[model samples]
Target: MKKVIVGNHAVSWGVQLARTEVISAYPITPQTQVVEQLSEMCASGELNARFIKVESEHSAMAACMGASAAGARAFTATSSQGLALMHELLHWAAGARHPIVMADINRSLGPGWNIWTEQTDSLAQRDTGWVQLYCETNQEVLDTTIMSFRLAEQVNLPVMLVLDAFYLSHTAEPVDIPDRELVDAFLPKRQARLKLDTAEPHSFNALVPPASYMEMRHALQEAMREARTAFDEVEEEWEQRFGRRYGAVEAYHTDDADLVLVTSGTVTSTARHVIDQRRAAGERVGLVKIKMFRPFPTETLRAALAGIARVAVLDRNLSPGRGGIFAEELRAALYDVPAEDRPQVYGYVLGLGGRDIRPDTIDTVIERTRAAAAPDREDLWVGLLGDDGAPATTGRAQTSADSLPGVEA
Candidate 1:
């Protein structure tokens, strides 16, 4: 069935179709609609699930952990500050190897008090051992939500699928809602390998002393490695059944291109239009959209960009004193490649605090990357505004060459 829906409702539809057994969340802007719809589903008997009412985001995750521990298919949704509040339990959910699925609407952290889209919130939780996937469209949001449950259960690790706030959360799009029977066939009842069973009562998440702590950590790392491969298997099955597939790292026009832009989430859609324009003009520009942030898709990235002349990573999230989070990680991932094959990575930070990253903004990035001998600095701020609301120079230096013109910062 096809229906026009916002991204949050797409998430709700996906969770409902997945036959999730437990739903727990605290309402936050952008993400509230996700759980709100699920609550209605549960309340109206459309979805037979326990909708746990939690007072806080931390408590919401705690409730999900408890439900998942009992071998139930659990789910939740949250945004920015709410996600930050659940930090501690995120680690617990992953450490205990619970296959709970979550939908995180990416919103900027507060102070100046904005509630617009940004990737920093979800990227901040990169090391929490959860498999992270960023969606570019509402359809992908719905599909990934269902696939996440299968991927998490297969690897026994929590999964978080992220979508941009307002851009996706509130913007309506036509989505093909999969048949409930098909989703059920694809993701049958989750059979947890280990759970808190009444008949077989046993210790769960007990203290690990120095003797075994390191090994347990190693096991978690191993599971992450396993997830990188399992995700492919899951996508493969999903594609076979549904005739739709979005790669963990999708490369476009890169086979014979000299420069390729790296992007994620909604920014990817914009970059694609620019790439198409550049291609039509006979310029060898391409794009790589990264969907899976965790399990990093290192091998796939290497295969796609090994011999590319220059690679520009446009990150909507910053790592404070460092640089763009995705660029930093991509640089590290490319470090081991043969010096001759590695592309010079230029990191451009933009669109933070929900700032617009338009086509001309991307055009500026491509022009600067192609003209520069090497990156002037690690983090090149794009579309920045000055104190008087004039176009500001790049973050590193305020030179005429660094000034961004005809672009919205």
Candidate 2:
């Protein structure tokens, strides 16, 4: 059935269809609606699940970890500060190899306290050993939510479905709410390959000796590496049944193009409109929508952007003095390729804190990026809205870089 739904509500519908057995969440802007709707469904007997109203985002994730470990299909939703609060349990859930699926309405972090869209929260945790999916529309949010469980369970890794806080979270759009029977057929019963709960007692979360700690960590890394194939298989199965397929990084109009724009979340939709307009006016610009952030799809990115002479990466999240978040990752993804072969990536930061990004603004970024391709040229800033709109900062600096490395770009 088709209905106008916000991204968060679409996620709730997906969770309901997936037959989630347990849901734990704490209220936060944008993400609050997801849990709220799910709670209503459970209360009204529309969905059969244990709805846990936890004290904080930290406890919400802890409860999910506990439930999933006990052999239940667990779920949760959060945003910005809430996500940051769950950082500790994020590692615990993955290390326990619990297949918990979560929806994160991406919002900016702050000292001034703002509630709006930005990828920094989720992107900051890129190495927590969880699969991350960035959705471009309400429909993708629904589809990705259902597929996340299959992919996460296959490799025993949790998956975080990240969407722009207000852009997608609050906007209404038509989405095909798949029949429950079809969802059941596609993502049936929840089964954990290895579980902590047992009819026969066994030790779990035991202390690991220093000699074996690194090896156990390596094992988890191997599982994440294997999840790449697991994700592909899940998407293949989904496409076979639903007639829709999304890649680790979805490419648009890249064929025979001189420049490509890379984006995530709802901005990709705006970028697409800009690309189409430019193409109509004879500009050879295209778009690359990055769905997976962690287990960073480097090889796939290299291939999609291999031939393009110039590429522009627009990030909503500011890394303080370092410019856009996604720009750095794209740079690292193509760093090893020969300078001539690697596309010249230009970074532009825009649309933080619920600010609107009209198609013309995106077009302006593309135009300016083309004009400033030289190595010495500074990073670009689009739609800065005020005098604070300084030229974009580039390369990692002490003030901007996170203490933990391996984030790549």
Cα shift from native, residue 104, model 2 (Å): 0.2
TM-score of 1: 0.97
Tens digits of per-residue lDDT for model 1, 276-368: 999999999999999999989999999999999899999999898887999999999999999899999988999999999999889888997
Residue 365 shift from truth in candidate 2, angstroms? 1.3
lDDT of 2 by residue, 154-233 (tens): 88899999989878899999999888888999998988765665575666679999998899899888988888878888
Candidate 1 CA-lDDT value: 0.92
* C-alpha lDDT (0 to 100) for residue 131 of candidate 2: 91
- Per-model TM-score on C-alpha atoms: 0.97, 0.92
Whole-model Cα lDDT of every candidate shown, in order: 0.92, 0.85
Question: How many steric clashes does model 1 contain?
Answer: 1
